[model samples]
Target: AERYKAANQRAVQLLEKCGTTQVEVDASGLLTYPIEKVDAGDQPDKKLKPLSVDEERFMRAFYEANVQEVCSAFEFPHKILATALQYFKRFYLQWLTCVYAACKIEENHVSAEEIGKGIKQDHHVILKYEMAVLQA
Candidate 1:
């Protein structure tokens, strides 16, 4: 519940900065953010709506199903899939914290693609560090 509140706050911050949460996809599959002048005094708390119980449940189910689909699509071994899923769960647990911290430090609205790329980069760094530790 606390994490959900933090995540909601982070999303509100992003929406307030970007004007809308929806991103435009171009013909080349590139995302373009819409720019609107939001009043500095605009209250995010009032503008952002919290997810209802049913919506939250649906989202959770959808995410789990998608994760399973991705694992199956790649024909990943059960052990490998389990490890990946664990990492994803752990990542999500910290996602709101990381995003909130990043927003404070950067003072910019981070896009979903940017967050995805950052996670992928972090995975690569972890793998490299693990390889180094194994070699030592």
Candidate 2:
């Protein structure tokens, strides 16, 4: 343990000497973003918009909870869970379809029928929604 610590210390010292330990300030504007304007989507002028930002967030959170529950029950891999969450946020898709899509994205390749049987859903629905999920 002592030798390991000494080796780590030497490595750190060498990093410092080479200026590799410097903390870089990200000056790229991409690192910064505008704060969300409060109730911006609640304005009356935007008639075509369905849900306001808060409403959408609430719905997304609810759906995400559902997805998490399903994923946990099925013991899915982390990548599938993450991708499902991304699909939830970006596409506002159904939790079942999101998981199905995430499985495809991660190359896990779970069949629609298997997922449907596991979840008590009709297999055809999964197949039907797969195209829509990928298109979005």
Candidate 3:
């Protein structure tokens, strides 16, 4: 509940000063679908058991740690950090490419070299994965 509230505040903040018609962060559509019909998410086998609450919490915490670490290294603003975290959690779950991909998604992309330096990783791997994603 608290996390949702925080996320809502951040979303509202992000929508500010943007020259769009959207005035508020409306999330009514997110709950319109029944869980049985949609919440399985990418799973082809609906018969597969769903994650327990503990498992879900653990997975979210694990990924969030990585998000924090990378965003901290980059010294990103609150918006970018939150946006990166959102992308990782909801869309692109690939930890290896989340940072660079998140930057690109937010329209504030940094150079691959800068991302490599920031994360202390070899730029070649970044290039390799980026190309793979682009090709796919």
- Regions of candidate 1 where Cα sits further than 4 Å from its true position: 1-46, 93-136
C-alpha positional error of residue 6 in candidate 2 after TM-score superposition, expressed in Å = 56
* Per-model TM-score versus the true fold: 0.36, 0.58, 0.46
- Count of backbone clashes, every candidate in sequence: 0, 0, 0
Clashing pairs in 1: none
Say which candidate scores most in TM-score.
2
lDDT of 3 by residue, 47-81 (tens): 24434445666888898888888778777667777
What would the per-residue lDDT of candidate 1 be over residues 1-136, giving only the tens digit for each residue? 7776677677667665655444443434355668555543576554655465457657766655655654455354555445445544544322222332233234444443443454453432222222222222
Off by over 4 Å in 2: 1-49
RMSD of each: 13.2, 17.1, 13.2
Q: What local lDDT does model 1 show for residue 118? A: 46
Q: After TM-score superposition, what is the CA distance of residue 125 in candidate 2 from its true location, in Å? A: 2.0
Local accuracy of candidate 2 as per-residue lDDT tens digits, 25-57 = 122312222443323234446323334445655
